[model samples]
Target: MKVGIADTTFARYDMASDAIDELKKRVSVDIARYTVPGIKDLPVASKKLIEEEDVDIVMAFGMPGPEDIDKRCADQASNGIINAQLMTNTHIVEVFVHEDEAEEKNLPEVAEGRARSHARNVIKLIKSPKKLIKDAGKGKREGYPDLGSIRR
Candidate 1:
């Protein structure tokens, strides 16, 4: 299988590279990599990886700023990825690290851990998606403490 990485040119590019390295330990897969200027550009880069490079799956990684607009832009990028996945019949795993996901002191650690975990997730998703099916609705950031179950 092939996994493409669509990464942004920001302070967190290392996180994506870290993900790639972490992924390699579990699976033997071909990698195609692309770097966009920023988070907003990730979708198009990911689309090209699928449509042009013919990768089986894509890992889109970005770090949005600590602002409302940045979050909104991340949402847009995510939506575009979803659309591309539907249109092309592929999976584009969205891995984003917001500036506020952790305390300022813990941001670096959380970001690295989250990216690594998500990379492993990308591999599992491609290999045996059923194993992860039950957690489809259990949305939580990868590197954070488990928040436990929510009750309505």
Candidate 2:
């Protein structure tokens, strides 16, 4: 899989790059990294990267509030972009701690745990094959046998 990781904030970008590298080591996937100039640049950057790289998946990492971040993700999706946002309550906590403290206290592990949780959430958001089968059965009762209306 070809994955693209994008972020407007420097810290998030760095963390995302590190996460992508870690993930690549675990899986046979190609990763491309991008840093947006600002929050406003996310949509454009995401669109361009997706088009240029023909990316199979995109992971957008940012520290924005939920509403704004959601809007950005929606915009990317509307542009035919498959993307995931890395959001967490602990974003602030991770940003505040020093690297030494983060390592000494196993913050990287904590961050990895958070990343894995986020990845799982993203997978759920994308709807798995099992979910499609379940929905298909419900759709049959609703007079739609295919249940292929759900768009990625």
Candidate 3:
């Protein structure tokens, strides 16, 4: 199967590369890559990758700037991604890293860890759907820390 990697140029770093490298160790799939200006561009890029490149799946990576507006843009992009997935009948695994994930305690590592983790999930989705079946309704909180019961 072919996989697509769509990342943003606005990112402080290229976490998508880390994910691709991690995926290479387990699967031998063709890769289609596209770099956009920011998170907002990911949805279109992902759709093109699926529709044009004909990829089986897509991995989306982006780092929102340290601002509330950036987070809002990310949220809008996420909604678009879902629409794109439904429209294309494909899966686009999103891996986003916020600039303020952790004050100054090495956010790059956090981004890398999350990107890689989601990459593994992509592999699992193709290789073992049963494993992810139980995760239904968990929402897309993969990279972020589990806050657990935000509102009781």
Candidate 4:
């Protein structure tokens, strides 16, 4: 199977690299990479990867600044991604990290962890979707601490 990675130049970190490393460690698949100027461009890049590159899945990464406009752009980008997924009937896992989500010193770590985690999920999504069902309500999180399920 082929996986597409659509990343933005605006991102503070190279999330695709971490995701690629993680994916390489876990599975063998072809990767189609496309880079654009910013988050708003990810949807089209992802769509092209699927429609033209013939990738089975896509990982879309973006990092918006901590401004209101940035948040709005992210939301719009997310909606476009959803529309692209519907149009292509493919899964485009959106991985967005806000510029202010972590301290400057920790941003890279946060981005890397998130990318790696999502890479695993991508594997599960294509290879064994049942595993996701089994993980339901487990409070699993990518790039951050997993909030374990609450129990009495």
Candidate 5:
């Protein structure tokens, strides 16, 4: 199996590094990495990876700043990613960490943990999607602790 990693240079942390490490530990797959200048470029980068690299899935990582403008950009970028998914009929796991999600001292840990957890999800998505379905309503999160299902 092959995996595509699209990361942005503007990110405060190198999330792709953690993701690659986790992927290496969990599965044996070819990794195709594409680096872009900012989060908004991720959609094209991810699509290119899917088309040119022939990866089965993509992991798009970005860190938006703690600003309203940044949030808007993130939202637009996310929509573009969704459009890319529909255009290609492929799954692009969007992993975005906002700078304000945690205190400055804890930001790295939060970002890394999020990347690693999402990496695991990526593996499950390809190898065993049933595993994910089994956890429906479980409120699984990437950086933070999972929130158990409220359903009875």
Candidate 6:
């Protein structure tokens, strides 16, 4: 599978790219990386990359709000593209929220695990069936959901 990864944060992008590279080595996968100026540029950058490369999947990594991410995904969809956003907490306040919850629950380990689990879930969601179809079409496979008649 060919995957395209983009992010606004250089450090996050570097980390995600390294993780993706390790994932590709474990499994059979190809990844392409793109760095964007900011969240506002994501959709445009993604669109350009999609047009230029043959990718089976396009995953965007950033700490943007859910609404912003949704808007970006909608924009990509309008252009017949599939996009997934991976949210990260880069703000100290966000980390404080987690820490507070950990203190309240008296399960710091559990809280940490939850954060890791959520990140994994995001990646899993990006690999869903609908996304697979969209990415496949963007990659080597052309058009999806054929309308031809079934002949038995």
lDDT (Cα, tens digit) per residue for candidate 4, span 78-146: 999999999999999999989898898898888999999999999999999998998899999888899
Task: Show pairs that collide, candidate 3.
Answer: none
- Residue-level lDDT of model 1, residues 17-40, one tens digit each, is 888889888889899999988887
Rank ordering of all candidates by TM-score, starting from the highest? 5, 4, 1, 3, 2, 6
Expressed as tens digits, the lDDT of each residue in 1-152 for candidate 5 is 89999999999999999999999998898999999999999999999999999999999999999999999999999999999999999999999999998999999999999999999999999999999888898888889999988964
Residue-pair clashes, model 2? 0
lDDT winner: 5
What C-alpha lDDT values do all the predictions have? 0.85, 0.46, 0.87, 0.95, 0.95, 0.41
lDDT of 2 at 67: 53
Q: Write the per-residue lDDT of candidate 2 for residues 44-128, one digit (tens) a residue.
A: 5555556677665566554332355655643543332223223211111111112333333465564455454444333433435
Question: How much is 51 displaced in model 5, in angstroms?
Answer: 0.6
Per-model TM-score versus the true fold: 0.89, 0.47, 0.87, 0.97, 0.98, 0.42
The number of clashing residue pairs in model 1 is: 0
Point out the higher-scoring one by lDDT: 1 or 4: 4
**Clash number by candidate, in order:** 0, 0, 0, 1, 0, 0
Candidate achieving higher TM-score, 4 or 6: 4
Candidates' RMSD to native: 2.0, 12.5, 2.9, 0.9, 0.8, 13.2
Model 2 misplaced stretches (Cα beyond 4 Å):
10-13, 65-112, 120-152
Positional deviation of residue 114's Cα in model 4 after best superposition, in angstroms: 0.3
**Which residue pairs in candidate 5 have backbone atoms (N, alpha carbon, C) closer than 3 angstroms, thus clashing?**
none
